[model samples]
Target: MKKFNITVNGNQYEVEVEEIKDSSTSAPRIQHQAPVAAPQPSAPTAPKVEAKKPVVTNGAGSVKAPMPGTINDIKVTEGQAVKAGEVLVILEAMKMENEIMSPADGIVKQIAVAKGASVSSGDVLVVVQ
Candidate 1:
């Protein structure tokens, strides 16, 4: 009989083995010690992540444009408190009315275009502080 020790994952285990021989038989008999169960692996976990929207801040503030067509309605006045994505003005572009929303939550600092006026792309229609 022979005894041996094995270590795995910082754990140690002891085992025994035996050998037997018969005079009439050519083959030798072998015996193995009881097997020790291996430790089970833990399941992997998913990482936690957060989703956020993009925001930009400048010295002046946020600026949104009036649509392509004529100004049909102006809903907000200057120095008014407005929330982010608030509709400030409406423009009649391509025979359809479009609402120009505020980019950020702030006070309306300036109004660049007047009611019933025309505007083009990249034009600053209003400023939000």
Candidate 2:
């Protein structure tokens, strides 16, 4: 004879059975169990209200990536003069196109990202002076 532990649904069980020999032996003992329903997790009571907006880094003569994405377009080049609010680059993130704008009127001193380059949030994309 042997003992075994078993689980059905959420309940546990311990059962014993007899071993039968091959020569003119009797039938083996069997056990059956019905499963009980398991406890379900509760759903959230409140839904989310707001999503955080991306950071705008258009100050101190440096422009940074607001989110992780690929550089789809670069509208300004090094040594190019740009006006405040001028669109300097286009970024593709989450299937949306976002324009990175200049914060002040200044000359573009450097462009840190190339077209089709991938950048992470807060990565420097441009320098103005």
Candidates in order have lDDT scores of: 0.72, 0.82
lDDT of 1 by residue, 13-107 (tens): 66766555655655555554455666655986677875423233334665545346788898899989998767788888888887777777889
Flag regions of model 2 displaced more than 4 Å. 1-55
Model 2, position 17, has a per-residue lDDT of 73
Which candidate number has the best TM-score? 2
Error of 1 at 117 (Å): 0.5
- Models 1 onward score TM values of 0.51, 0.56
The parts of candidate 1 lying over 4 Å away from their true place are 1-62
Error of 1 at 75 (Å): 0.7
Candidates' RMSD to native:
19.4, 12.8
Model 2 Cα lDDT, one tens digit per residue, 1-129: 787767666576667777666678565667754444455659745767764333357567889998999999999989999987788899999999998888778899999999999999999999877
- Model 1 weakest 10-residue run by lDDT: 50-59
